[model samples]
Target: MSDHFLMFVPTDPTWQPTKADAERAVELFKSIAPNAQTIEAIFTDDVEFHHPCENWSGVDCAACGADLEDWFYETTDKVYRENHFADLSVTTPCCGLHTSLNDLNFVWPAAFGRFALESMRPGLDTNEEQEKAIAACLGSDLRKVWIHL
Candidate 1:
């Protein structure tokens, strides 16, 4: 079975909204995607990566645009095992430049954050203005990720 999710994650990897703000954002998203089967905000103790699941295409080096899918998996695994993603710092394998797993260019628009607002099976798409409103409710800029799994 496969499911689709529309998720909004904070741009800052370690940012988390207050429970009240998260609840408000959930309500706003529900209003925007009224027919969605479920809508909620997920809070975590440490920064976690949110990928587009089966919708993922691949990733590229943010600095040089080199394909970095293999590097991404290796690096993310490294950090996840090291500290469950509590720290996201790293050096780009392709360019030897300093960066982080969260800073890489994910082709399918993934993000790392301690907070995420997600809508499951929403037969709806939000316009820019609506998106901004939800972001305001969360008090943070957001990156939208479409996930299929």
Candidate 2:
């Protein structure tokens, strides 16, 4: 069994929405996606590593087309082990080019005061239009992350 998650995070890395903002965003999301549920920000300090692909299997170095699974695994291990919440920047072994983890299209998880909304349904597409509405309510641009687990 697997679960799919579409997470929306603030575009500004340092922005954290207030409780009122979250509530408003939730209402906006509910208007368009009636099935979405409000999920309390559990991993408040955890920043997501998102790839363009749906699953980790398709991850590769942009410069050289080399597989990045091992690198991603290692990085995941380090982040969880160290409880690191700061942005991650690394040099790909394949091409030795510098890239910030944010550059790879990852969504930074909502911080302590903010809230994240989620919907768990197989094969549900990330509704960009709805996301934009929520972001507009929150007064910020949002970054979307699709997780298949």
Candidate 3:
């Protein structure tokens, strides 16, 4: 059986909200996903990758528009080797330009962040207005990811 999850993360991977702010954001999310089996905020000591699991199409370099699957994986391997994505920096193999992994052009939505507000088996999808409102409440632009595992 697959477990499904919906998560929101800051566009800026390093951003961390205060406990109060997280609670407020959770409350706002709860209003939208009232039927979620579980809804809560998670804070990690270091940034973590949030991908769309089976929905992943691939990622590309934002600058040169080159397929970046191999580069992204190898880079992620190195980044997580020490501090688990303490750094998201990357140099595109095709363009040779510096950028963060979080800035890559993901075919499907994904994010890397130290904080997340997530719902398990939520059985719901959010609209643009709801997403924007939640982002405003969190004081950060967000990336929404749907996961199945």
The lDDT, on a scale of 0 to 1, for candidate 3 is: 0.90
Which run of 10 residues does model 1 get worst, by summed lDDT?
93-102
lDDT of each: 0.89, 0.56, 0.90
Which tens-of-lDDT digit does each residue in 3-122 have in candidate 1? 999999999989888999999989888888889999998998888788898989999888899998988898899889999998898888778868878778888899998988988898
- Model 1 RMSD in Å is 1.0
lDDT of 3 by residue, 1-149 (tens): 88999999998999988888889989998888889899999999878899789989899989988999987888888989966898788788897979998999999888999999999998789999999998888889888999888
Pick by TM-score: 1 or 2, better one: 1
Residue pairs clashing in model 1 are: none
Please give the clash total of every predicted structure, in order: 0, 0, 0
Candidate 2: tens digits of C-alpha lDDT, residues 5-54: 76666655446677787777766665665565443332254554443244
TM-score of each: 0.96, 0.68, 0.95
Best of the candidates, lDDT: 3
Better of 1 and 2 by lDDT: 1
- If ranked by TM-score, best first, what sequence of candidates would result? 1, 3, 2
| Backbone collision tally, model 3 | 0
